[model samples]
Target: MFKYFFVVFCLSLFIRQGLALWCYECVSTQPGCGTQFNWLFHWTKICPETDDVCVKIIEQRSDETIITRSCLSSLRAIRTDIPADHYEGCRPAAKDVHLANYVNNSIKELDIYRNYYDKTTWCFCFLDNWCNSSPSSNAHVYLIIGTSLISLVYMF
Candidate 1:
């Protein structure tokens, strides 16, 4: 009985470690960043330990819109005013942030202009890697866990 418990515990640990949170990282100007986002063209990145959630930023100027996807920590650093309570769902921040910091502090070099922006709405999620993209993003993660459990069961 003790040996069985130890084996189960080890397998559980393995499964947990194999799964890491991933987010769709991209900007509106990039391919697949539009309304009909092409998943194949979108880049998925593992969320850093410091970023516990994925965030989507939508800034609407007079006649243009800008959309950006990144980890919560990244956006928080630039915006700096996201209320701690507004950690999930889509909503406009109480204040509008300037684009100067975002353009200058950006880690990626983009041909698309980011210097122009206005009122912004932010969305945050911790459900799955693509939670920032869609509601059904968690399915694949569940499937992976299911497969791992089956393999472990068959092993013993």
Candidate 2:
């Protein structure tokens, strides 16, 4: 009986991993998923096989703070520039994905690559289903709070 139970448990773990990752897909307006986050039950999407991480982008332009929650595919994630341990906070948009693609495929010039951003656009990529539901920050207090929440939501 114990052996049978162990086999079932192993199978369950494999099944869970086989499923695609899900992220909160919403904009700043609509159901109000902006600076004050609102995690509605329907604000989610199962990511494609190429996309395994959830991403949240908060852009502060002029007088508007646009919050966009989406998914980041592995196409650019495999690039050599983005560090493996960059899943911490809001990363710079240009270096992480945008211009990095051009630099890697076309230019291949690392020296001329400057971190550029119009207004304040913070991009955060995480590896958990529905992880982008919250509006996060770089502060240590927010980091601690986020870690605890992740422990409860994903790690458990």
Candidate 3:
């Protein structure tokens, strides 16, 4: 029983460490992504720094805007630089399929990359502070409260 518990504990710790590393990597990647991509949903109204070809396809789209400004903005501000052939390589949806579906799928995949990194940045800091601080939980609560206030202020 002891051996099994020890093994499980060790595995959990290892997994946590791996997750922490992944979180750090994600945070690091965000800034570049933010600069390169734009939302297909708001493509007509906004010019994302993405490839001109993709922009054209997005703008000419007659159906739903799957890529929102939020997604594009996130990509442009956080992800890596867009590739030269990005647009040329993007496959158009079949006539039978909804355009929105394709856009949504693309945006969703991009979002997975962004979220893995972005949320990690926020959570990692919170966890680090939680672990490093001594004595009462007051400091952790204070940090959380302060960050919440700051976020609220930015939102409004």
Q: What's each prediction's TM-score?
A: 0.60, 0.49, 0.17
Write down the worst ten-residue block by lDDT for model 2. 74-83
lDDT of 2 by residue, 58-84 (tens): 656567777777766632453334334
* Candidate topping lDDT: 1
The lDDT values for all models are 0.68, 0.56, 0.29
- Candidate 1 or 2, higher TM-score? 1
Which portions of model 2 miss their true places by more than 4 Å? 1-18, 74-86, 95-117, 135-156
- Residue pairs with colliding backbones in model 2 are none
Model 3 CA RMSD to the hidden true structure, in angstroms: 18.9
lDDT of 1 by residue, 63-104 (tens): 787778888766666564465654678887554354344455
Compare the candidates by TM-score and give the number of the best one.
1
Q: Order the candidates by lDDT, highest first — what do you get?
A: 1, 2, 3
Better of 1 and 3 by lDDT: 1
lDDT of 3 by residue, 3-94 (tens): 55555565565466532311111111233223233222111222232321212122122432222122223344443423323322233322
Q: What ranges in model 1 sit over 4 Å off?
A: 1-19, 96-116, 135-156
How would you order the candidates by TM-score, starting with the best? 1, 2, 3
In model 3, what lDDT does residue 29 have? 28
